[model samples]
Target: MSYRSGFITIAGRPNVGKSTLLNALMGQKIAITSPKPQTTRSRITGIINDEAYQMIFVDTPGMHEGKHLLGKTIDKLAVNSIQGVDVVLFVTDRHLGKSETKILNYFKAISTPVILVINKIDLLKSKIQTDEIILSYINAYPFKEVVPISAASVTNLDHLKEAIYKYLPEGPQYYPEEMVTDQTDNTLMAEIIREKILYHAQEEVPHSVAVVIESITPNEEYNTVDVTAIIIVERSTQKQILIGSKGEKIKKIGTAARRDINKTLDTKIHLSLWIKVKKDWRNNPNELKRYGYQDE
Candidate 1:
């Protein structure tokens, strides 16, 4: 029996359901998802290991054209993830907008085996139009394979998985079936808190908020865990919004995040969250380095 394992990257524009698609494929929430653009700032790994093959899928932040320090740094991270993947699943939306062309142009310079995934087919009122959208991409370039799938729904993922494996070079399994993600517990916990922030906060706040776990101490005697985190924001106005009137907003964010943390850890959690303001940290090189977004 031959086993195949290789890297596959899900790269596309923000809010294009890239992370959601990876979660669906892995059948677990290895990556966070929200309605906001760039919810995933890091390259999250979602592993799908089967008996015959183990497929490692990387979900990267949306590729946007921005030159701001933060934007450029994030863009660099996204582009760097493209290298050395066995197959690059260039995801696109059926709801092609003014920026769709720009998204397509990203692949024009790539040399990897590009498999165009036209996601969000569930939203299409007419399935017959799938051909035209597929053709639009196919006409642009000779894709290895073009497959349409609804990432949010458990629709056509078997086909997507099959299409992914078809391009993967046959090899041995990279990881055991029990492991699903590469993110550590600390990073995953921070992401869970950040996910809650994105869910409850306003549009701009999601992008500005960063959760860092200062310390995590488990206590068996008290049957609870102690966690301290600092939620950093870019501006004072955002800080005010995050704190809310007498800190109701932060309270809500804490409740939502604690429940998830408890579930992830399978224990009672005594989580303490605080907020801080760092003015224009996104553009500050020092802050960017501290935030782990710097190029090494």
Candidate 2:
């Protein structure tokens, strides 16, 4: 029997369903997802172990133009993750445009085989339309295999998995069989909190907010975990928006985040949130490091 195992990086533009595709592939949520652009700010690794192979998937921040220091750091993180991987899953949708040319050029410099994953085929009206979109990519690069899938609907994912497995080289498992992701509990909790803020708050609030879990205490007898976290914002007005009138908005955010945390941790959750104004923490190197956005 032959075994296959290797690292695979998923790279694409923002809001292209990169995180959604990752959740579907893992059959669980390891990365956070929201309708907002640039939802993913770090590199998340999900592992799939089966009798035949172990596929390590790296879900990276979407490659884009950086408008600020934080944005630049995230873009760099996504780009750096592509190298040194056994394969690359370049995910994109039907709305292919000139901005994608830069990404294609990046792939040209890498020796790794890239599976051009044309995601969100469900949006297309017909097979002909789908083929037309795929052709544009085909003309640009020598993709090892081009697989069209709707990551949201879990459509054609089996074929995507098959394509990945076919290209993976034989090797030993990189993680334990029971392990699904490399992210720690704190990171997941903070992300869940951030995800809720992205969903509940107004559009502008999502980009300004960053959640940092200060402490997590587990009560074995109660089968519950209590979490304390700080939500960092750039301005005092943004802080007011997050906290809301009489703390109603914060309460709503906590309720939503706690529900998801309970499911992820398989325990009762008590989440405490605090809003703090950091006055441009994104550009401050020390603050960025404190918030877990480190340069590679």
Q: Write the per-residue lDDT of candidate 2 for residues 1-296, one digit (tens) a residue.
A: 79999999999999899999999999888999998989999999999888999999999999998887999999999988889999999999854587788898888889999999988999888999889999888788899999999999999998998999988999998899989999998899999999999998886778888899998898788777878999999999988888899999999999999999989878788888888999988888788888998545
lDDT: worst 10-residue window of model 2: 93-102
Question: Model 2 misses residue 172 by how many Å?
Answer: 1.1
Cα TM-score of candidate 1: 0.94
Cα-lDDT of candidate 2: 0.90
**Residue-wise C-alpha lDDT for candidate 1, range 108-162, written one tens digit per residue:** 6777788888888888878778877887666666689888999888788899888
Residue 76 error, candidate 1, Å: 1.3
The candidate scoring highest on TM-score is: 2
TM-score of each: 0.94, 0.97
Supply the global lDDT for candidate 1: 0.83
Minimal lDDT window, size 10, model 1: 95-104
